[model samples]
Structure formats: structure tokens, C-alpha cells
Target: MATSPAAPRAASGGPVRLSAAPADVAALIMHEADLLDERALEAWLALFTRDALYWVPADHGDSDPLRRISLFYDDRSIMEDRVWRLGHPKMFSQNPPARQVRVLSAPMVEASGADTMSVRTKFVMFEHRLREQRTFGGVYLHELVRQQQEWMIRRKVVHLVNRDTVLWNIGVPI
Candidate 1:
């Protein structure tokens, strides 16, 4: 969608120098995390673009979500399905449900254009379910697009620092 003059501009907003702490973009990112932690999947999905991707690579620094084994490589349709399953009473993995606490730091702007920006941030996620807790630490790289006058995530790639290790089947969305 064409950006309206009233739209909240990102780092590339004219002569202003981009800072790591781009307030507007950072707020969206944090809000996304909060939605997930609250298990508000439907609300969380609204933060993405229609063709968005939620990817978790099997190996650190891997970009090929399709070619490699991944915890998740969901597109829009898949995301919706996952969200449905998460709320389904019959979904076994969620027997006890999962609780999560995620901390995201100021994102480093990797690339920025008029309608797109790539930002990377460090994340430490604590997920607990079924009497067990797992701490997942990694870098979250997000590619956001300007759509309908908002910054929507086009692609969110998560590279777990311990991706090389076995996951034991994490029952929760990271």
C-alpha cells in the first residue's frame, strides 16, 4: 500500500539519521513479542503482512527456510493453522499449555529502504510447559514492509544459538 503522509515513518524517514533505537519500529517488535507471550496467536498474526513468513532455522545463520530442517517455516496459511491447533483442546502438546517470557533488545538496523527495513535483535526466551522449562536464546532478524500505513513483518527469521542441538520437540511457538 502507498504510504500515507500521516503514516508513522521509520528510520529512512528523510534526513533523520537512523538509530538502533528506532522507537516506532521497536514498539511494533515488542508488541509482537508480547502478543505471543500472552498466547494471543490471532492478535499476533495481525502483525504480519499477508504473505509473511515465520521461520526458525535448524542451523545457526541459515537463511534457506525451505531447504533445511526448521522448527517452523510457516507462511500465512500455515500460521493460521498453527494458531487454530494451539487453541484446539485436542492438541496434545498443549496439555498443560506453555508460558513464555521473551526479552528483546534494541534492534540493529541492518538494511533500510523506502518501504522496507531489516532489523536484527537479541532475544532470550523462557518457555515452560508440562513441568519443564527451556531457555532459548538467539538472534531475531525481521524484514518489515510498509503496508497499509503500518510496519508489517514480511519475514521473521529466528536463529537459535543452540539450533544444532536436539529440541526434544518444543511445544510452544518461539
Candidate 2:
């Protein structure tokens, strides 16, 4: 892919114009949700850039992932392992794979640059397995970067509302 020149910024250090339209941004977010819900792990992994980071903070107040304990923090290598585990038929945890449905609010673009955008969205996910149902709600913070013509996730932070509390099995990706 041909690299585009860096976008100009305003005096306040913000992008003067967004690289993607709001609708496009929302569509990407929705597509990601669908991929996860459908258990299309490989396709979902393709949405992320090679160096992407996926994080779920253990505490709402936690900042630095390296210094603070996180519920889940994964880079490309870790993500690949996770994908493999989730897809493996012998993985007992997923023997009777959980059924999940995610509902997301409108994604709001918080910042934009020549090739990057930051988005925030609220979501609630319901998972059912082994005759038990679980609900999780939180915000998704995505840092997306345009690679050629497609937007890829550079970082995704999942802030669970009940992060600090002990939770049941989260066998599937959130």
C-alpha cells in the first residue's frame, strides 16, 4: 500500500480533517462486533494491525499496563495463541462454545489524524453456556489506523464495569 502524507494538524495539535467519515467508523466498529459474536476469530484478527494491543484493565484507575495488573493484555503473538485455543476442537473450555450477542451504542470519534482515529463506544454483551447466562457491560476504546484504504485496529481497550470484582468464566473473547 502506498503511504499517504501525514495530515495537517490544527494549532491545538488535533487533525484538521478526519480521514474517515463517521459512518465508516461506525461500520468498522459494528463489523468487529459481528465477527466476534459469530466466532469468526481469524477474520476478526485480521482487523487488527500487526502490532495491535488488546487490553482489559483490572481496575478503572489503572493506566500503565506494564506497571499495573490487567485482566487481559495481549499483543499479536498472544492474540494468535488465543485464536488458536478458541478454535481448537479439543479445547475443553469451548467444547460447548458459548453463544454471544453484543449490542453497541453509536461510536463517537474522539480524535482524528491523517491516518489515525480514536473512537469510544458503549456496549453490552450477553453470553450463554452450560445452562448459565452472563451479562457484561462497558466501554470500548479503539485506536484505529488506516492501512492503505482499510482501517485496522492499533489498540483496543475494554473497560469492564465490574473489572475489580471476581467474575465467572470468560472463556470467550470479549
Model 2, 1-174: lDDT tens digits are 101113346899987653344888899999999999999999999999999999887776567889988778899999999999999989998779999999998886667889998887779999888998888988888899999998999999888886667676675678
**What is the C-alpha lDDT profile of model 1 across 1-174, one tens digit per residue?**
111112235577754333584788999889988998999999998898889988887765455656778888889999989899889999877877888999998876767888899877789999888789888888777899988778999988877887777688665568
What's model 2's lDDT at 133?
85
For each candidate, give its TM-score against the true structure.
0.85, 0.86
Q: Indicate which candidate wins on lDDT.
A: 2
Model 1 misplaced stretches (Cα beyond 4 Å): 1-18
Per-residue lDDT value at 93 in model 2: 84
Per-residue lDDT, model 2, residue 153, is: 93
| lDDT (Cα) of model 2 | 0.83
